[model samples]
Target chain A: MELILSIAIGTLTASGVWLLLRPRTFQVIIGLSLLSYAVNLFIFGMGRLRMDAAPILEGAGSDPANYADPVPQALVLTAIVIGFAMTALFLVVLLAARGLTGTDHVDGRER
Target chain B: MGALFDHLIAVPILLPLLAGALMVIVDDRRRPFKIAVNLVSTLTLLIVAITLLMIAGGMTASGDPARTSVYLLGNWPAPFAITLVLDRLSALMLVLTSVLAVAALIFSLARWHRAGPHFHTLFQFLLVGINGAFLTGDLFNLFVFFEVMLAASYGLVLHGSGTARVRAGLHYIAINLSASLLFLIGVALIYGVTGTLNMADLAARVGDASAENRVILEAGAAILGIAFLVKSGMWPLGFWLPTAYTAAAAPVAAIFAIMSKVGVYVVLRLSLLVFGPEAGDSAGFGAHWILVGGMVTIGFGMIGVLASQGLSRIAGYSVLVSSGTLLAVIGYGTAPVISGALYYLVSSTLTISAFFLLIELVERARDAGADVLAVTMEAFGEDEAEDAEEEVGVTIPFTLAVLGASFAGIALLLAGLPPLSGFLAKFAMIHGMFNPTGLGDGLPIGAGTWVLVALLIVSGLAALIAMTRSGISIFWASIERTVPSVRVIEVLPVLGLLGLCLAMTLQGGAVIRYMDETAASLSEPAGYIESVLTAERVARAPSGTPDPAQGADEETEVAP
Candidate 1:
């Protein structure tokens, strides 16, 4: 399970980086989103793999070791929201630029 | 009211938020009301800042400052709840935020209002974030503060709504938004690993981590570091700095000057507190790699200075160099070095800001267009004498003198010239390197120390040469043109800025001591951690529960 998650994260990161390097404005935005997701997952995984039960003990038994660290999950939750806000703001700006300049290249000029 | 006063910690942020809300309802055409709010809000900020500074001074003297002051919102205690802490570092930064804010507010009354109605509101809101970022004890709060500042900055950057201003501001926001995304990810990773969001708790916690956990922590740190490096304009990550700074309106640029140091302060604060050997025992952790990054930034900034032709851009480049120098010093990660970095930060901030404000005077006087000097001269020589009816105003005579002083501040004071505060601060740092009476590791005693000494000299000389080139191009060459009539509104702010720079240089002694204390507190993280965790720490295992979670939050607490 750990190995599969690791490959999945790595693949996401690589593709995201490739997109980040592209000249197209839309591609770069997509790349940034992808990269942010990969990073979020990677950080969450750093709490060490957990198979037992959820951290809270409302119904089932709960132990510190048994629960996947909920703290990182909380942090990731905030990151996802902030990331979405930034991406949306940038997307609007990007669209505006496209409308104004008639180009969607990140560098602002047509190749 | 008493409960609110008890939480003196939150006032810096709360005050600005209230002021900004109030200003929007103010009539746009009533210049006096707008100016009045700016003054009162800024003055309140200064008062709170001074009170905070006094509190920090008391803590530093007490030595065992954990007993100092810990306030959580809604009476929530730390660890289980969000915390707000004011130890030596944040308190010191809070003071500076207020000082710079007040200075810029006063200056902007005549400077930025030309842009439009909401200018003062945007300014107050921006301060709300700056002060909040310094005071916040949690990662999420820092991100929130960052947005508040960035959003306001976007409006300020394009405040005049010029085609060029909007274009450059867009690029600036785009880059910053990406950095904000990375910041969020870094925070998430750290939270995932450690349950606590409080910095003091993180400091004590991250150090005790297993190897796998350490990897996670370091990864989080690196991502955050990259984000700040971009903000602070660190070497390769800072290509956006010159164009963005040079592009902004002058008074706007002056306020923005303090913005980059916020990044440098955070990066240094985190490395020394979270990654230091005291916390992690990682020999390579808080090493001199940051210093090398600073050097590259300095070099890049100097190259930009020498290569750039116009005053606006040249001033921008000088600021970049100043950022580089401060980063390099902070990279040293020693108490003495950090103290020196603090002095350099203030001195450079003042000088560069004064110079940028002066640039506007030059721009108006020669009727030089705002973009590039070359473009300005071309347009001026070819255009009708339409602007001939307008005077360049009060700033013309002293523009050269102030510009010279700014370059000198970087060269003399920043490079440690004697009789100047910069020199004294630098002396304290180098002396600490070999201070037999102090806390430094023994310097190379003879040859190695000498080499370090020689390098200092070379770097100083290089900075001087760079400044000399800048001085010649910006003022000396530009002086060959005819002068237009000057105005009073513009000249007063320029003079005021100059006066402040001079005072800092002249009386930099007391300032340096305060700066040193700020540095000392960060170099030894024990005080910061002890203060934040005292309420709950007595319950841990007698043999010792041994936690590194404290280190994570402590490292993140670094204000930028």
Candidate 2:
């Protein structure tokens, strides 16, 4: 499970970085979204790969090691929401840039 | 009253937040009402900040021995929940942020506020984020506040939308978004390694990390440092800063003078608290990088200042130079140098903010092409026709005189000339570096100290040259300039900021004492950690006595 998750993160990050370096504004926006997804997954994986382990405590004095760590899950949720908002904001700004500068390049001019 | 004071630790974050939300419900068309709300809220914040500063500095009658206060969210114990820790350093930053906000808010009242929709809301929210960033004790909470700050900054940067602003805002958003991602990864990695997200807890645990975990922990810290350095406008990562700051509206840019410092503030706080001398294998983990990065940033900023064409860009690059000096001094990592760095931080932030506000007003008097025309005329000799009507000993207009004088004051401040707080700050910093172990210790200074001293002097000289060249063009050389009709509202903020700088200079002894205490507290994080970790939960109503099983259920319920 860790191997698959790590591979997924690495692939997402690599593609994101590639797209991030592209000149087009759309590419950059997509790259940011992909990178955010990779980050969210990485955060989720930070709690360690656990299958079938309940995230909540069973009762008082229950051993916490039996439960999957819920903190990273919470963190990933917050990251996803923030990432969504950022992506939306970035899209609006990209459209504005395109309309105003009459170009889709990140620099706002045709190179 | 004492109980109320206990909650005041949260007000800097909450007041602006509630005010921002309240402003959202008010119709944006009612500019007067919004302005009144903003002014009242910001003024209240200033009072609150001063009170917090007093409390943190132990000036209050009810002073605690630790001189630190922690406000746990939901009245929970410290490590289990998010906390807002208020100490001398955070209190000082709060006061500085509020001061700059008041000035920027007042300046925006003149004309810039009308350029965009929901300007007041964005401005207030920006405060919420900055104040929250200063107060948050949780790493994830810091990330959240950072996003809040960046979100509002994006809107504010694009507030007075122009082609240049949009372009610059695009890059700013893209870079910051990437940095935010880095921040997240770093936080996650640190959490995975340390098993705690709370800063105090992390600090306690960081020292005890297994050898294998220590490497990962250091990597996480290093990554986090990169994120902060980018925000702080350290050289390579901060290439987007000058352009974005230059393109931002004057008031927005003024407030942003503190924004870069936010990065510096976090780096300083975390480096000292989490990775200080106590952090076993990780003690001083990234200090050398910060020192070298800062000096390089200083060199880059000097070049940018000298090479920039516009006053605003010069102001932007000056921000970098200031940040570089602070970072370098922080990297030096002695309590005394840190004290002087704190002083330098406050002085340079105010000066650069005043310079940014002053730049807009100064540029208002000259044509957009005045710089180009001035340069061409300098390159090719002045036209005979233009020289024919050159007036001898002409009297400067009242407005021009005031603007020029303010410009000169800012120039002196930025260039670290004598008789201003800037010079005093640098002098204190150099003195601290020389006498790291107090007077007469005669400790041999390292080669790095010499490099830093040289960089500080050279950066100041660069600022002097840049300001003089631009000042000559704007104030003296322009032939067809009309005196801009400046309003009292706009000018008051600039003067108020400058006056504060003057006050800092005049009251240097007291202020330096405060900064010295703040630095001493920062260097030894024991009190901070104790206050944060052992902060007591507020007592609940007697009727709320709960069973342990029920309490456990409630905890699980709230966990997600």
lDDT of 1 by residue, B396-482 (tens): 565446545644554564345765555665566567556634666554465544544455545555556665765666567864774
Instruction: Give all candidates' CA lDDT scores.
Output: 0.69, 0.89
> Model 2 in CAPRI terms: which quality?
medium
Q: Model 1: runs farther than 4 Å from truth?
A: A1-12, A37-77, A95-102, B1-5, B24-32, B59-68, B367-420, B434-463, B466-489, B535-560
DockQ of each: 0.34, 0.73
Q: Which ten residues in a row have the lowest lDDT in candidate 2 chain B?
A: B387-396
Per-residue alpha-carbon lDDT of model 1 for A20-91, expressed as tens digits? 878888888888889888877876786667887685433224356656667667667766786787788668
The prediction achieving the highest DockQ against the true structure is 2
Candidate 2, position B280, lDDT: 92
Task: Please report the candidate that would top lDDT against the real structure.
Answer: 2
Please give me the DockQ of candidate 2 compared with the native complex: 0.73
Q: Which candidate should be chosen as best, given TM-score against the real structure?
A: 2
Worst 10 residues of 1 chain B by lDDT: B375-384
Clashing pairs in 2: none
Residue B8 accuracy (lDDT) in model 1: 81
Classify candidate 1 by CAPRI docking class. acceptable
